[model samples]
Target: MTELGKRIVNILQKKSSWESDKERLLKEIQQMEDLDILQDVWTRYERVQKNPDISGTRNDPNSLLAYYLDITKEKPEEEFKNEKRRTYGRDGWPDIDMDFCDDRRHEIVNFLVGKYGRSRVASIGTVQTLKSKAELRRVIKALDPEKSINYTAKKPDQSGNFALQNEILGTLPKILKKRDGTLLKNLQEVYNEFNEFAAYMRKYPQVFETAKRMEGNISSSGIHPGGIILSPVDLSTLCPLHTTRGTNEDGQAGASKAMVTQFTMQDVESLGLIKIDVLGVSTLTTIDFATKLVKNNYGIDIDLSDLPLDDPLVLELYNSGKTDGIFQCEEAGMKQALQQIQINSFDDLMLAVAMYRPGPKDYIPQIAKRKQNPNLVQYAHPIVEKHTKSTYGIIVYQESAMHIFVELAGLTPTEGYTFIKGAAKKKPELFMSMKARFIKGASKISNKQVAESVWRQMEPFQGYAFCAGHSYAYAYLSWKTAYLKAHYPVEFICARLTEKSRRRKTDIVYKYEQDAIKNFGITIHPADLNRSKLTYIKIGEKDLLRPLLIKDVGDKAAEEIIRCQPFDPDDLLYSFGMKVGGAVNTKIVEVLASAKMFGNIPKPKVLSIFEAIKAGRQKSKGRQTGNLKKGIKGTVKRRKKTLDLDF
Candidate 1:
């Protein structure tokens, strides 16, 4: 480890936490400068990366501030008297050849609106929403009354308008001038408004809970993931809240909430402030699927918490390729390999799980053959045996790489760990290139050919593979789930595949039929609205585990139906709030049908729901159109045509 890294570790050990954090991480070289080692490290790193720029130029104030200004800048020709670039200041400071007081005002207003609500947010922004000549006149008077309000210009009684445009663009009318400039104190106003809004929101527990539930779990809509809202007290106290003038750790440009709602999620984050980002994750969805099914099967009776850590059935399945229901072993190739080895223990299970992939699967058959006949299993060396005994002298996982690094390369725990994480998953070519360099840097290696051979062996385990610890943890979860599935087949499968929506409706159906119902000869009765449960269900006397597999029903619709009626399929549609005004849409019908709402309804009537859905949607569209027309007419009549002022 570098001296700085060691120092950081030492500091972390003492404090049991970080103080400066993002600042310290990005500007560690600043600390090193005190020791005179900064120049050497920075220079060397820059040379290695072949980067012309300094390592931390993002920390440069002038550069950071200039970047902020650039976001608000526009074409000079668009704003000025004409297109012109007048040079004035030296490298660090540049002069604005043209006044963008108009653009500045607009940006300020936008920022205010975002930080505060539209009603609360205010900056001397462009008076674009002026209601009348009086409102315009009031704004113009605020700027420079003498320069604006030309009562006797080309046309008489020019009450209010922009001053600059009045002389050049147009006559000043009763309105704020487009060139109305914003003062620095406007920023203070915006900041105050934003702070107030943050405080106001804090009063509402609902919003806070919503923000909390969504804290780390961002969805399709919300604030930016890494963006944080920093309050003054929080900023000065907890952390430095160091920023490049207007932004935070988040990818926020200088845009504020009022300025643009779009940037609530962008580059702005502080320590105590909230960070919300909506992310799409297949893993979360997958977990949702598993959880839903489990609920449906046992009427909330299944205990996922009761699953044991070391179930012999799961281990046996892992070894014997009977892992169809396990998370990792549902696939074809994995199943085939497992059946061959028929693993005998947890170590064997972990090995099977680890070696079941491409880079490792090739060695599986040989390993399996050897396990079946131990005489054929060759120990390449005592060192190799020491490293690979768990898997019979074969390197397969990220730990294998870490192991080689520790045993052969004499690297420290931290260094070995870093190499394992960084290089294990990398491609062979990358691993080879890095290994060559590492070997070349070694002084003990004399024969280049022998060194190259040793390096090649190191390449396989270096890229992005997991540390055995993580993989084993995952394997344990997998085994737990598999054990539940293997031993308590009906209860476990039902729990796993209960609500169609718990997992994908289709997937729940597939598992209920293919894996659970079929595997155990459990009956899958058609969904009957009168008797069907919204989740994976058990029917009277027969104890048949039926899935909500109604042809038209989706999981959500099914859940709603179940909630409204408690799985009584025999309930009348009208009784369940299916009003005559075409309330039967595709989603509603799908839910009802999936839950088997209609026991005797023919295909003819069932199909009619499609037309009903379309007709209902059309009626809704018509109402929307009429309302929109009314709004347009009302707005048009409200607008007075007596004034004409160029904005």
Candidate 2:
């Protein structure tokens, strides 16, 4: 065994609380070694271990060694009676996806570059190809830049060209979508299936034929968002390297100082390089911030990763359809599904995540009806019942299909995985051949009629089936967030506000601030000089001081105000002018006054004092400015009728 294999054995021997079967752990370690993935698993484990505070990492769900090593956080307990299923890449590379706080994900990436020499670590590149709609427009421009083609005229005339152009443009086919509303990448499939589109293409071969040739040509190259490749040798020696422009926070490409591979993710992986997906999930940041708030306000330290899966109040929040900040449960469709299904257990929540997708979506009503009345639940065969009993005897997961393929069809795990992938990729020949093999193999176990029936049950959902690993991981995060929101509403909202504020989404911040006030019943005080800091802070039992959300009042102004705490409303402008000049500008003061940061002092009076000071400065350009101070004092003293008007 290699050092990586020995380390895996050591971890399984010592850290086996999650999977305590010593013999089973050893077998899994040996299987990983035999599969030539042990070194890759160890490499990923080392990279992730450097960032101890990462949310979690998810490896191949079948890699029990990964779960034992804590590289994959979710346990692989059987959801239903389905046996375990493992899907490998064509080249047998294992996927190790790491999730981190969205705010701090750059730190880990930088650390990886430092550890592995900079030349060895680069972001995966992607080639942006022209799609059907873009190709149609491009072809139209290239053929007739000056005028449109007139199909109806004898001389190919230009008089009624615009109308004819509109007619031809209207025939451009809309992109095809999966049953789940996800846009499919294949325009050829769209052309083949839609009769009107195919007829129009044949009718207008000049434009359509040119478009077909130029449809998939590369337009631009850019870096992948999350995929980072770690090559053993210098990357430049193996493939070309390019410096890509940075993407802004708003997702626009701009000037950047980062290196990327010239090849795409598939090409890089094919070159025998390891790619680690360091996905930045903002919800993880939300959970982290909320937990820290809980610790600060209530002195209750929350270990979010170790949270119990079964919480009645969290489940009740999901049931109530008030999951505003909870992950995966906030969407209106998901909330409606929650209401209909009434998730009674963690298992149900996981199933809901899995089932609430495109192809499996059709089974939700059946599952709900079955859940409401258990007698309606029936399976085509015992194998089906055994695999799908947890999901109300319906195939709701891709793993369930794999179980049927292996157990019923008697295909090996590798063959079953290939069949599932073939179906997913829409490889008609591969899928049809596998389907034939499945029916033949299954007939020996059960009758031919029964085998076909069970296969039919699996066929419809195979393409759209959600991965159980993904559902479990997401459901775990969703429940953790729901638990925090149900118990600690103030902390969660404060965290959400701070995060949104950091992102410069003031509209969303204010929206959630109002939500916190109306729904959480928490009073949000406007940004105050005496109380407010850089972020939302819990002041009283039910009160939270809103951060400096006023426009033009940036970090410098907020920080200066914090430094000079407890400002008198009467002398705020004077104090800022004397102590924090330029930092607290006249516009910032005006906005603050408008935001009611000055307590009972009226907005007009504050602006007039600054106006009076400006007038006094003009009058005494070179002489004594003593009269300006007195004039500001006079303006500050006018606080009488402003109180009694009750405006």
Candidate 3:
């Protein structure tokens, strides 16, 4: 036998403790390998776990093997079963399967829920089981007239649908338990689960929080669309973690935040993983989409790729700080910040990109004064003047470190770049090695003191150090978004509002709607099946696009609404004869109607959105609730003139 097989046999013999036959254990292992199940069996075997033994053998490996296969085989069947049930309506309201699937059976859902808490499990939006449980629990609590009331119930203003579901689920102990409601245990109560998940969080908080925040949570208010999931395994297997996502989907996956590219260097080495930043940039998409419209509708394919950097109008917009509708500059505070910073050129945009964040935002005012008056800009050393003159003597770009290395340490351009990336990733060991190499390789005066000063400066610079190329690329995008916001604001806000509420609660969505209404003075619409464009589409009658286009609703819903336009369906999946709407799609439609998108179509359709309620139960179809849910609407006089394209 091969040494590997011999070792396996030897280990099995030792585990049996001379009572169990060696040949029997070896045969089991061989059988497992032959069935392509050795890895999973070994993986579980190596992992110590506690559970009631039902197979009547504590040390018998065969029981474990059987359990492993049973669970694994159960996984894909569950997945496909859910997948096969969805029905796509013509109006884009595709019936998403409200079911959870696991690749491995081994009580994976239970283990994950026990480890992460059911609420978090549901929040990630990946699993339907956890979502069902959480919703069931939520309803039981919500409608318990004896317990509490945060918001009024939709129907009869007396009975909450969630409350009713809670009652139904409370009795489910018998229905669910193979014994007593399948021994209904909250994943949290299953071995003190949420705390266990929290412990795991404590064990790997940086990675956990980073991974969690990157858009997988279905319960999360953020967008984790494209049916693509960026899981912890992929993250662990990829790059070192960082602060944030890029402006859109694909770019949202990887780490290190803005301006960093896939170019491998000292940063990746220090972080112990490849450093590839997938920037979640939506402005790029919006710009591309808008440009396509401009090309097809207006006959000018204004190539942003070839557009000259120094446009007077673009500069004037940047200089004025009317960045309200601008991509990076939409926040009122950002506008105030820009006015303080007095951005003038492409280089100014670069600095603006870096200084906007929490870490380096303090420098904005000082740099603003410097930019407004050239004489005020101070230089720590000649290197500062040399490197930062483009950004008005401010160290915004990570390139400053490279510049310092070249000017002071006498290193090559390439080596300086590597050193900067290393420092930025907070890799002290790699920095030390780079320091040694630089010290050893220097041809002329390599005074340790001066080199040490450069190193000290690089320390603060690393945390705030954004890639120069990324800033430049993003500055262009930021400026473009700002331009659209400023010039075509109606179109801009419509798109911006529909980005879906990323906060944990529906109230966050409310807050965003309020912001759009109060701060930006935009007319809000309700989510309606008829009036709202599938996604946020710029209506010919209005200067703005529709918020329905937000990733919250897909082209499926939009197409449904558009294609079924004038063929208004009351509830989601009405075409499919379903009472309860698709979970997310129903919400988006309701939101669009609330925004008043359906106001112009018909009186029945234009009824205030507060009238809409998700009155149903999410069941084996993922915990759903339904009943005549309702809300109040403030009276607003309709304008005689319809909002039309002003441009």
Candidate 4:
């Protein structure tokens, strides 16, 4: 083992006891003060030990060590005083502030498993419930004993057999809308418009009843996309464990057979298991690759966390609707909204992400108008203004609602958080109970009339809302990505292409390529067998597409081709096949040749050379087989003659 590895192991082994190990570990870590990285680790470890409830640490040695080593170092506490945030769950879990790349995130996860043992650390599972449409279809299938209704229609024309049910269920919006074109206004209005469909529904009322009963029922169980739970003891002692096979967001099967808790995230959390979101974000991967490219190609090292959040070029890119690959700001609607908002500050970016959802989306125009004319923005009361001023007097975030409850309603921070959580989750009982308490409390601080208006303002937040801290975290990443794209277009585009090239359809990468070439004036060279790596690479001012992006070239073959570069066609084929331990087929060579990857070599010539190499290998194999057969026959004859003589 390396010196560092041995030192780490030694530090871990000097444990006095389970409860006393913190002090021992800190003392041992302090001895390694000369190692700056270990000193940083010791600092974080000391902080975590001092405050066991520090959000994200969970007091587990593994969690503390991972947080200290992998998480991005934060600035002093005073720097973050202006932007206060909340931690909803137990302290010491991963959040957006960590800035972990996909690989680093997985590395931390693996470290947890190694530290706690696989049986004690497992990813949390989630239960997928049946939605309205799925429940309706299932109930219809069960009700129709003769299978008369063909509800699974691909087109409107195919709905002739079950037009009434299909049209009503399929055409109706997921969230009921009023005649005035506002969502969640009056749900009954949706059923009132079903003229003929009403008759069909009345005839089969049992179907509707069964569907309602089945809706929201657990349909299947799968591993949570990111949540990982660490048990204080063996996980099997708390919950049942099972192996689930499925792909993650990256469409990878490495975690297909990962052991997961049979219980859902809520179940594990309710059981007091410490859970952390170990999400694998492709944007972070893109940023990592982009920064590496910038450093290698331009000899410039970039610290994304330290990037200027108010760069004019980055804001201009957002305002000009040039955010095709920016995180969270790439959607067409988001881009259009950015053109109106003209993001100038980090707060604007935070509001943009927080307000781009369904409920808050409707208020975009009002927010934009307020941004354009600040005099038009108004609050129900001065207290409400304190919280809403940041969002242009608009309740664009859940934090705004929480602040309203705290400032206007005179509720404690904990109560305000509860109210916001209940409202965001649409918990009718908790929401109504909190509303009554809020009104009573507000009557003491502010008038009931103004309080009622403030309450109404917060009502829309129930539809959709995001935590202020989470929004800020995402906006920070979005700004970082935008900054990179604006200043380092070639590197950013190459990184985006590299990350997105793994998808089945290259449409996203293709669109990025078009923008890079047309908008950014970055030349995209075709994949070169000699120059192209496994991923897109920046060469001077031009970006070379990866050979793996070409059709019919698998990653293994591409790696082989890239490794056996600087060789002629015949030698290249021979070396590639020998290194890969497989045949270098003519089809791959033809693909490379067609892509103009072989310099001036024609496709026909490349194919001919490959075929000649294949023929020579076949001839050699035939000769070896013939000699082996002749030798075996002679040995058999000699053995028979010797046996006869012996007899």
Q: Mark the regions of model 1 whose C-alpha exceeds 4 Å error after superposition.
A: 1-310, 319-322, 413-422, 425-430, 433-456, 462-464, 503-508, 540-560, 563-583, 586-597, 605-647
- Per-residue C-alpha lDDT of model 4 across residues 22-127, encoded as one tens digit per residue: 5533443444333223533444455446543232311121232332332332221211211112323322322222334564466656656766777888877777
Q: Name the weakest run of 10 consecutive residues (lDDT summed) in model 2.
A: 638-647
Q: What are the per-model numbers of colliding residue pairs?
A: 58, 1, 71, 6
Return whichever of 1 and 4 wins on lDDT: 4
Candidate 2 structure lDDT: 0.72
> On residues 363-389, what C-alpha lDDT tens digit does candidate 3 reach at each position?
788777776788986665576577777
lDDT of 1 by residue, 1-647 (tens): 46655553453444422443334333433433433434333333333244311111111211211111221111111111110111111111111111112212233233323453443321111112223232323433444334545556676444443542243213222332223322222212322434443353344334323433333222333322212232334222333222223433222333343222322322223122322211222222333444554466455544442455466766665655545556677787888877776767666767777777755677788888778777875553345466667776566656565555555555455455445545654544544444644455332533455445545655555432644543554455566567666665665555555534344556645754665544566665665554556555655332544544455555555555555554323445423433223333555664554454555554344434334334434445546643533443333335432221111
Question: Considering lDDT, which of the candidate structures 1 and 3 is the better prediction for this target?
Answer: 3
**Model 4 worst lDDT window (10 residues):** 75-84
Q: Each model's TM-score? A: 0.46, 0.82, 0.44, 0.75
Q: List the candidates ranked by lDDT, beginning with the highest.
A: 2, 4, 3, 1
Report clash pairs, candidate 2.
180-358
lDDT of each: 0.43, 0.72, 0.45, 0.65
